[model samples]
Target: MAHRIAVAGATGQVGREIIKTLAEREFPAADVSALASGRAVGGSISFGERNLSVGAVERHDWASTDLVFLAPGTTGPVTLARKAVAAGCVVIDVTGMSDPDAPVVVPEVNPGALAANPRIVASPVAGAILLSLVLHPLQALGGLVRIVATSLQPVSGAGKDAMDELFSQTRGVFVNDTATPEQFTKPIAFNLIPHVGGFGEGGLTDEEEAIAEDTSRLLGGVAVAATCVRVPVFIGQSLSVHASFDRPIDEAEAREAIRGAPGLTLLDRRDDGGYVTPLETVGEDPVFVSRLRVDPTGPNGIALWCAGDNLRKGGALNAVQIAEELARRGALRG
Candidate 1:
């Protein structure tokens, strides 16, 4: 049965991508509503042949919606989600902390988590999903015990404004214009900032803490230590992950596991700059993995690199996949 769906934050990059993904995957949505702030209510967005008029959540009828895709800037979706759920709509939250009781899901990694809880599912940050998609595959080979990850994140994660900042700054720098640091704490063009989210205790940024927490939760409680950096790139996210397993693992065994996993594409090559990079992975679905080797610094350490589109796989695509998972199991209710 086709469900009636509402996509909140419909004007943002990830929200727009969610609509695109839903249409591309042929999700069984009998009607799709695009939702945004009140100012966007009369605005319109294209969804295939239909031009969906953006509706203000303040006035939208939650009772008529079957599923709600919550991709609003972190805080915007909280109230709408509660109301949507109360109105009997299952919600797939993209970047918010949904009801604490709601399962944060990566469908490929943990579909069963939602089998019983159909009302709400939260999508972890793209960084967490990217890391889990690549690292979780090795669970069968003695399982992951600990992970140390350094994420080279793109400006897109910060939002559309950050992306604009990067572009305008880069252009400003080239034409002998001053690249101002406005949206970011520092100029993002032609530079790398080793800070994302606010700083937390123990010298870890909030983004790092989140990656650790979400990775552990998604990967069945494996400890994660993350250092998140904001790079100048416009799209895609890359992680250099050093994983320690409970048992000995060699390059061949690790490569085999990474290459064969779902939602991951092995792109490791030995020579001539053969490896996955953010530029090559933006707009792609599968997490492109490369640079697999046994870490020489420590025992039982397996190191690898991974990249995926921050907008798609990291945000919209993951959200869409969660919806698809719920629909496949007939968990979506109007």
Candidate 2:
């Protein structure tokens, strides 16, 4: 039987990607609805050959929906997810608003966690998504002890408004026009912003905290430290991850392990600089890992660079993948 699906925040970047991915994957959807805030109402979005008119989410009856993909910014997703699930819809939330009670899932890492709650599945953050794919192979070989990562995040990580700001600022700089900074506190045209989100206690930005916590949760490991930064890039998110394990690790063995892992592409070529970059992986679905160097700092430490499309693997694609898995398993409303 085909499932009836509704996409919340359907006009946003991640939301649109979810719709595109659903169509690309040919999910069994008998009915599909696109929902957005009042401001985006009347706007039209194309889904394959059909054009879906944007409807106000507040005015929709979500109870009839079988599954709802909530891709709104941080604030809206959680509330809408709760409502959708309470109305008998399975909710897949791409936003980072996770409850301690809910499973923070990276499907490649833990598909079993989805079985615990039929109501909601919380997608991990971009950094967590990249790290989980990289660490999965390592974790299979040996237990992971610690991980240190630094993210070179793009403007799109902040949201669509941030991307707009960067584009306008870059154009202004090119034409010698005065540009104003609004989406970000600092100019993002020619410069990088060390800060990504609001700062919390102990001087960690919210993005960093989310990355660190979600990485640990997704990997099922307690020891992980992450330092996230927002760079000048536009689409992809890159991470330099250094992981320490309990046993000895060989480089060739590590490469073999990564090659066998699902949803990961190993681009490690030790001969004269053959590594993956953010530009190379901007639109790619799989996590790209290269520059695999055996860390001399610890007994079984390995350092690798990882990159993936933040909009796809990090947010939208992951959510759609989870939905597909659920559908395949007859977990979505039947």
Candidate 3:
């Protein structure tokens, strides 16, 4: 059965990708509505061959909508999520501001976390999604004992304005025109920012804390220490992960595990240019893993590098996949 779906924040970066992903995957939608804040209500967006007129979220009829993809930057997403759930619509929140009670789901890692007839589900941060997808496959190689990862996130993860900031700042550099920091604390052109989020308890940035918390949650309570850095890249997110396991595991076994895992692509080679990079991963779905090797420093330790389109699997794609899982289970209201 085709469902009536609404994508909130449809004009923003992640939102636009969510809209595009739905159409690209040909979701079973009887009617698809593009919704945004009041200021963006008059604008338009495309869904496959059709151009959708953006509607105000306040004006959208929630009761009639069968499903809602609550994109990041959505207006009053928490309240809207509650309203949609109350209206019997299944909601997948990519905004990270959904109900704290809602389960944070990554379909490739933990589709079973969704309850039968779940009303709302939250997707983890992009770094967490990227980390989880790569690490989940390795869990079979004995239980994951400890994880230490450093995520090099792109500006796009911060939103459209940040992406613009990177572009304008870079162009300014070429023309000898210095730009002020607005979206970020410092210039992002040809520079890296170690501070991705506000400083918080234990002196860890919010982004780092979130990556650690979400990765642990998704991977069944394994200890995770994450350091998130904002890089000068545009589209993809990359991570350097060193994980320790409970038992001995070889590089070949780990490589084979990743190769067979769904939603993951292994691209490891010993040559200089044999690893996956953020540039090549743009617009791609799979989480590309490379530079896999056994860590000699510790028992049963393995290390690797992974990258992927953050806007896709990290946000929109993960939410869509959860919707697909719901559809597969016939848990949707439509």
TM-score on alpha carbons, each prediction: 0.97, 0.96, 0.98
Each candidate's lDDT (Cα)? 0.86, 0.85, 0.91
Residue-wise lDDT of candidate 2 within 60-151, one digit each (tens)? 79878999888855336666777787889898877767345567888888888878656888888888999988898888888999998998
Q: Of the candidates shown, which would achieve the greatest TM-score relative to the real structure?
A: 3
**Deviation (Å) of 146 in candidate 2:** 0.7
lDDT of 2 at 302: 92
RMSD, every candidate, angstroms: 1.3, 1.6, 1.0
- Give the C-alpha miss distance for residue 274 in model 1, angstroms: 0.9
- TM accuracy, model 2: 0.96
Best by lDDT: 3
In candidate 3, what are the lDDT values of residues 1-334, reduced to their tens digit? Answer: 9999999989988999998999999999999999998678988999999999999899889999999999988999889998998888999988878787788889889988885667888889999998889989899878999999999999998888999999999999989997899999989999989998899979999889889988899999999999888999999999999999999889888999999999999998899999999999999999999999999999989999999999988888998999999998898877
Better of 1 and 2 by lDDT: 1
Ranking by TM-score: 3, 1, 2
